[model samples]
Target: MNSLKRIMVGLDLSEMDETLIRYTAFLCSISEIERVYFIHAEKSLDIPDEVLESMPNGMPADEKLRASLIEKVESYFGPDSRVQVDVQVVEGSPLKELLHWSKVKQIDLILAGRKFHMRGSGVLAQKLLRTGRVSVLFVPENIEPRLNHIVVSVDFSEYSLMALDRILDSALTRPEVRITCMHAYEVPTGYITLGISYEDFDERMKGFARNKFAQVLERFPELNDRATLHLVKQENEDDIGELVMVEAKRLKADMLVIGAKGKSAAALFVLGSVTEKILRYNDDVPMIVYKKENEEIGFLDALLGND
Candidate 1:
């Protein structure tokens, strides 16, 4: 619903990829999607050398693979569906090719599988997160789709506001949709740290959180009538990622939304922490990461060079 007319599904040519493609097709069936691209990114070495010995056979093998993948997709969607789908095979890194094709083809949404064991701090996932051009939906293996309850994390940042606005504007928000907006506050403790009293710090933090919640509700009056607000106080936990996952599981939330800072290419390649932690431990629920855009920055932010 967020101008997502074109969707690109990243496929790995495996059973899991097939499941992801089918799940994506199911989601698109209910939307105004005009086209679906089934993209398979393969390493150049995967192409058989014997087939490549002759230029004609090399092209034939690639064409055959494409046709097979297309056939599988069509079969899963059934013959009655009117969604137009095309198959593409590219040679490069999977994430790189997906991002490049999404931009070049003007894709609005990207649907990809979430790897469970491949959960270490990786650059590929971070790169996809920083791609502000398209909205990404990660489908975890063996998880069914649910649109009943959603949990959105807010910290009074413009990125959080933008994410909340987008979710409210999407098709996911219907009369049956139940949304919970959560704000987590942490109180610093321990003698090894600063000498500030933990109790006093907690009280101040709670007051600040309450005021911020009121301001957020006032700024977006439409959400006041639709979503419920919840404030969580944590004294020992510092990792917001872990807290968010635990709370989502406790509430049985179908999805989680967070505001993320876009990291530079070099930083991402070296160590991707935030997204990696979330994806590794919270594979049950989908996450929608929102990054701040230039248009959302105010004059004050521009003066401070925060934009």
Candidate 2:
């Protein structure tokens, strides 16, 4: 599990900013986060000379934006927060600036707003998960700012283990917080070719999932009863991401955790199909897509000034 000592929160000055900032403060209070950077980006920092001259203190556009963001941060986090807080205003696309600055800071986790009915395209948050090497937490506009129960979407892949491991090792799992491992499985159509009945194949698939869960338990026996395995049967068009979200709703899960394709698609390093679907459909639950820091971003490393 990688320690999330430094986190970057992307702010676009929308109504989501309040939720993002307050939620960031909530996370900082719960986790071992050491530094938080609140960043806002603009397409251009250039202002007419007349407008600049008329400014009260002659502050640059970036500086003024920075001051406003600071007040917002201080309001939620308080002036004497033990965590070091910095507000940055940058030029260029918000998505580009966010990825670049997060890498530059070697940030551990990124908190981005998942807009439901916002003005922006709301693609930035999804793109960040797809393009960046860092782990990202998508905080929706409507959230309770509490994390009592976490649901990990598992396919028994390496990514699943990575997500579970991080949750198990993190300070966010303080005694009361529990982690649930949820897997969505389907009976392969090829089972018919193998002379297996649909019902038998379904049972077999579930048993295989249980065995995988047992392996997970063996790998992290410390998880013990704090985590339990749940396998859900997924039908055609049911969508694994949607199934996980449904399970989350049933469990009253506060946070959803899904792992990224690392060793398998290191070069591509994009969120898997299911993860992308979840990002699109989930607007009420705070979801985190976890990516290992050591994994290669492959071609993404040089993408659109990702450096």
Candidate 3:
């Protein structure tokens, strides 16, 4: 009876496919996720008209290839599985197809693998992170499963509040899951008076931020028993992305969660830079970018097509 009824996992048909399936199965087992969708995207072949005319009206090799991939996915994740599973193969862009499928089917979560190399820009991943309605779980390869340390970055924004609530409501709230709520603040340059004696503005700001954290904690009583707070000071004038990276390393956190935003007024149409930078640069740790909306721009929209 878990609320996350449908879970979608994007498959690349790579060596890590099995691991992705195993992780998805593990999640479904824990959350009682009712449906699991396995999606793979393929490009349509450019065969000459003469070649098509010569072929008989029978199953093509591409179809067989798609079938084999689906079978492999189902065999690994669907065997003796209580959760209902469906395999889908679609033509066109991978990210776009995945988002379209998610929206059309109303998926509750999207599970995707994180690449270590800069094979291609993660436009689809970024889009899904920013505007997708469901929660996203980005799993890094070779990460040993452990819930020992969980880091949730808070900006005191409504989006961060929603992300924190979702984490607590999900598997993260378990007694064994060690949770750290982090907030990083940067000191303004003018705060230091040149003529007068050094003011205690930094101390006052820290106290104010602590009070804000306290207010958020009061709104969620469930976290009181399972969560611990950590306040960070960013004296280097780095952005939120840098702050999160520093905090993740300092805490040796197993998972990082952040809220996504749009970039510019017009380009600000999708997920913001913080989430994208983490996904691109930080491959050592797995990150989850939670979204408030159901609609998301696909990978192809951002990378393949020009604006």
Order the numbered candidates by TM-score, best leading: 2, 3, 1
Which of the predicted structures, 1 or 2, would earn the higher lDDT when compared with the native? 2
Q: Which digits, one per residue and each the tens of the lDDT, describe model 1 over residues 1-307?
A: 4555678888776566666776777667655677888898777736665645534443565675676687788776766777777789878777667866876787766776666644322334445665443567766666676677888888777767877887765555666778898887776555327666767777788888888888878987867777887777755645666776888889888878776655543454444455556655677686766554432224323322344
Residues 1-307, candidate 3, lDDT per residue (tens digit)? 2446787888766655666787776666556577889887766644354544533445464455456666776765656778888887678677667867877788877888776643444455555665445678887765666566789888888888877877766664467778888888766676655443224667766788889878887998767777777888876656666667877878999888876543332554644466775666567677777776533344324543435
State residue 182's C-alpha deviation in candidate 3, in Å: 1.1
lDDT of 1 at 137: 70
The residue pairs in collision within model 2 are none
Model 2 bad stretches (over 4 Å):
47-57, 262-272, 296-298, 304-307
Largest lDDT belongs to which candidate?
2
TM-score to native of every candidate shown: 0.78, 0.90, 0.81
In model 1, what is the error at residue 158, expressed in angstroms? 1.2
Q: Who is ahead in lDDT, 2 or 3?
A: 2
Better of 1 and 2 by TM-score: 2
Among all windows of 10 consecutive residues in model 1, the one with the lowest summed lDDT is: 295-304
The global Cα lDDT (0 to 1) of model 3 is 0.69
Best by TM-score: 2
For candidate 2, the lDDT comes to 0.82
